[model samples]
Every structure is written in C-alpha cells, then in structure tokens.
Target: VGRYLVQLPRGALSAHDDALRRAGIRVRRGGAVLGAGGKASLGPLSPARRKPPSSSPRLDAITLQEQLERALRERQARPTGICPVREALHGALLEELAGTIARDEPRRGTLLRRVAGEARMTIDAYRTVYEKSLLFGASKLSEAAALKGNLEGRIAELQAETASLADEVRSLTDLCESLEHRAQRAEAQAEAETHDASALRAEGEQLQGLLDALRPG
Candidate 1:
C-alpha cells in the first residue's frame, strides 16, 4: 500500500479510491493533493513512495512520531523554487491536515485508553507466559550442564582404568623376561653337567684296563 495519484474516471476513481483506502493505501487526488481548489490531479513525484530500503537497527529504533517530525522539519528547512500559488496551496494543505488531526485526536485517545485497559486486564497472564519461557530455557541449560558433567566423570573413570591396565601389562612384561632368563641358564647348566659325566665314565674304563694288565698278563 502506498500514496498514489492514480487517475481514473469519476465513477471508477471513486470505487478504486474506496478499495485502495480500505487496503491501507493513501490515494491522493489532484485537488486534494495541493489544496481544496487544486486541480483534479497533480504530477507524479520523481520517485514513487514504495517501501523504503531496509533500515538499520538504529533507524528502526526511531518511533513513528519522531520520524514524522523529522520529515516535517526537513521539508520546512529546505529552500525550494516553488511558485507563489503552489506555496499557498502547500500551506493550505498543511492547515487542513492539522485540522483533521485535531478532530481525530479525541477518537484516537479513546481507542488508546480502551486498549490500555484491556492490556492491564491481561498483564498477569502475559507475565506468566514470559516466566514459563524463562523456566523452560533454564531447565534446558541445567540438563545440558548435567549431561556434560556426567560425560566428564565417565571419561575420568575410563582414563583411570586404562592407566591401571597399563601398569598390569608392564608387570606381566617384567615377569616374562625373568622366566626367559631362568630357562636359558637352566639349559646351559644341563649341557655342562652332561659333558662332565661323559669324561668321568671314560676315565674309569681306562683304569680298569690297567688293573687287568697288572694282575695276569
């Protein structure tokens, strides 16, 4: 919806005007655009009044009344080459707008008061709504923290168990090395004893032979 100076036949224009207004469009007529005795239509503005480019957070923070005041002040502050008749028409247009706003102020105030009363009636319920949202968010955070703590505890237990298993493995490794050393020593001793026994048997046979020779040769 926008402010438009669209031209149509008297009948079509009236119907179109009603429709546009219902849809929140500001339809400007030629006479209504300048002043009460202005023409049936005015020339289209250089740039159409479409939605303005998206504003920043700082601009969005400006209230509607403030924006309106700033726009009025800017227009008044600027120097223009408007002809005398056009300037007069512009002044008349401003006067008419002021009168219209003055007339509507009471109705607007009544609507505002009614709305404020309704809001007051529901304020407690709205408070509960916000409280519930906070409670849910806090609960989720609490659960996440608990889960994180449990995971950390489990990791610590696993690390401790792994360290204990590693020590047991080291002890087993040392026992195996000792057993291997003992087996090797026993094998060497058995080989040496067998060699000594063979030498002793051979000496005893030679001594027997000598005794036979000395007894009855």
Candidate 2:
C-alpha cells in the first residue's frame, strides 16, 4: 500500500477530503503523518509552466536606425562633387559602409549605440551629394544626346548629297551612251554616202569611154 501527502488551499481542503473519503482513501486534514512502509509522494494539481531563455538578445530597431543615420551623416560631411558618376560612387560607398556597420563584430546593440548618430548625419549628407551628382549626370547626358542628334543630321545631309551625286553620275552615263549610239549611226550614214560617190564616179568613166569610141579615136 502507498501513502501520500497533499497540500491544498484552505478553501479547497474540505472538498478534497470529501473526495478522498468517497474514493476509500484515508483522509487527514493539515499536518498529516505517514505510516511506516507506506510510500509517499507530493504534487499533481497545478499547470506546467515555462520561461524564455535569458541568454537570447533582443533586437532594437530604433537604435539600429539611429546608427545607420549617423554613419550616413559622416559620409555626407565628407567633401564630394556633383557629377552623376561621382554620385553613383558615393551611393555605392554609403551602401558598403551600411553593410559593414550591419556586419560589425560587436553586439548589434553596442555597435549601434557607438555609431548610430554619426551614421544618420552621414546618410543625409550623402543623399544631397548623390542627388546633385545625378542632376549633373543628367545634364551631361542631355548634352551628349544633342550632340549625337547633330551628328546624325550631318550624316543624313551627307548621305543625301551622295545620293544626288550618284543620280548625276547615272544621268551622265545615260547621256554618254546616247551620244555613242548617235556617233555610230552618223558613221554608218557617212560610209553609205562615200560608196554612192564611188559608184557615180565609175559610171561617169564608163560614159566617157563610150563617147571616145563614138568620136572615132
């Protein structure tokens, strides 16, 4: 047989004793004694509980943002020019700096506390510099576009001139061909006239021979 001791809230003690009696278990109210050879145990009426581990770190978004802002501010304080390419370089630099800050060796909170203010200021400064640089780059690109357009217009004009020249050459070639054909026709006409003249001369000589024979010489 097993023996057990149970502790209960004063209000629940009477109810517990009644239930134990109904179950044929011996009931003793406060300060009960256990008999020899009776095994005893305690506890089973409360809900199980758990607590979160104390070692885990908490994330602080505000501190991290502040740190980033400070780093950006420092970068902004550095002298920079307003060119598109330069602005792009500055943006890249800021991004790299942000990444380094995010991957700092110390705890995130400690690193943030150390650098947050400066990073914020640097970010603002970099923003202005980058914007200006972008504007300058856009202007330069616009100028380059205009220059390209002008060059294209000139090329088009040259092409048109070349086409005109080609057309003139074609016309000249046609005229030359016509002139050669006319020259050939003229030469053929001249040869025919010369043959007729030779035939007329032979006939005149034959007539003269007949006249001489008639004149009895």
Candidate 3:
C-alpha cells in the first residue's frame, strides 16, 4: 500500500475498503482480500457479510467524515458577520500579518517618522518658550540701561553742585583771613594810646609841685 491513502469513493463499501487498506489488508480486483505481505486470502470484506466489531476498522473514517461534512454545512449556514469561527480565524491571521509587517523596514520607518514628528512638535514648543524668555531678558536689559543712564545724569548734577560749593568755601576763607589781619592792627594801636596817657599824667604832677613851693614864702 502507498504511504498516503487513496481517495475513497462515496459509499459504505468504499469506507470498508479504505479501512481494510489502512489495517494492512489489500483487496484485489475480484473482491478477494490479501494480507499486507501478499501471503494469503483473509476473506472478502463486503458490506453485506461484514460483522459489527470483529470486522470493523480500528478507526471509523466514515463517521469522522460525516462529522466534518456536518460541520462544514453548519458553518456555511451561519451569517458571515456573526460567525465566531470565521472571526477568530481572521483575527489570528491578521495578527500574523501584523507581525510580519512590523518586521519590514518600510513599515518600521513609517512608525519612526510618526515618532519623529511628535519630537519635532515638542521641539517647536520649547522654541516658543525660548523665544519668550529671550524677549523678557531683552526687556530687562533695556530697563537696566535706562536706569544706568538716569544714574549717570544724576551723578553729573551732583558733581557740578560740589564744584560750586567748593568755590564758595574758598571765597569765605579769603574773607576770614582779611578780617583777622585788621583785628591784629587795631590791638596794636590801642596799646600805644594807653602808654601816651600814662606819660602825660606824670609830667602834670611835677609842675604842680614846683608852683606850690614858689608861692608859699
């Protein structure tokens, strides 16, 4: 017998024949059964003379075939969209296809491009923040420059005022020195007048004493 069983015809006799062939019994052209080694005739395995369990094949291919056929009929009778079997099989196949596509370089590159687009959006957001920060810094710097200019102007005014004060102080110092010299000369004149008064008083006293001596006899 061949490794693969030949397709059996659709009948009880055909099933019996296939089963016999599976069990290492071969039927010849004239309905005689021979052993697998061509030894001798076992008997004929016709459907009419076949007994129940004694002549039965180890596995009944007819019953299994009937079950498969019934299952196919039921599946065909079901609505296409609501059938669980079809959906499950389709889902499994889709999962396998997805896995295959995921491994392909072009599909992977498309996913990478999507991620890169998101990254670019994030970078743009940061750039906006950076630009606002730069504007704020520039504003602060401008204010500082304006304040410095104001301070410089105030300092110039103060320096000019200080120069005027210094000139006034110098004039006052010159006036004070002139007044001190005048006060010293006035003190010397007062001392010389006091000495002259004392000398006049002494001479008058000596003349008075001589007159009094001559008038007395």
Misplaced by over 4 Å in model 3 are 1-122, 203-217
Deviation from native of the Cα of residue 215 in model 1, angstroms: 3.4
**Top TM-score prediction, candidate number:** 2
Candidate 3 minimal-lDDT segment of 10 residues: 47-56
Looking at candidate 3, what is the lDDT of residue 136? Answer: 100
In order of appearance, the predictions have TM-scores of 0.39, 0.43, 0.41
lDDT of 1 by residue, 1-217 (tens): 3222456554555655546555665545433442233224443222232222244535533653465456556556434432344344444444433433345586665565565557545855766787898899999999999999999999999999999999999999999999999999999999999999888888888898889889975
Which stretches in model 1 have alpha-carbon errors above 4 Å?
1-138
> What overall lDDT goes with each candidate model?
0.60, 0.61, 0.61
Cα RMSD for candidates in order = 17.9, 18.8, 26.7
Q: Model 2, 21-118: lDDT tens per residue?
A: 55666533333422232333322212111111133223334544565557557556444544444444445445444444455444653555456557
lDDT string, candidate 3, 1-217, tens digits: 2122333443535446556766865554333444565444634244322222323333544654565456547667454424556444444434433433455565775665566567657866876887899999999999999999999999999999999999999999999988988888888888888888887787788788888888968
Angstrom error at residue 213, model 3 = 5.4
Candidate 1 to truth, TM: 0.39
Worst 10 residues of 2 by lDDT: 44-53
Of candidates 3 and 1, the better by lDDT: 3
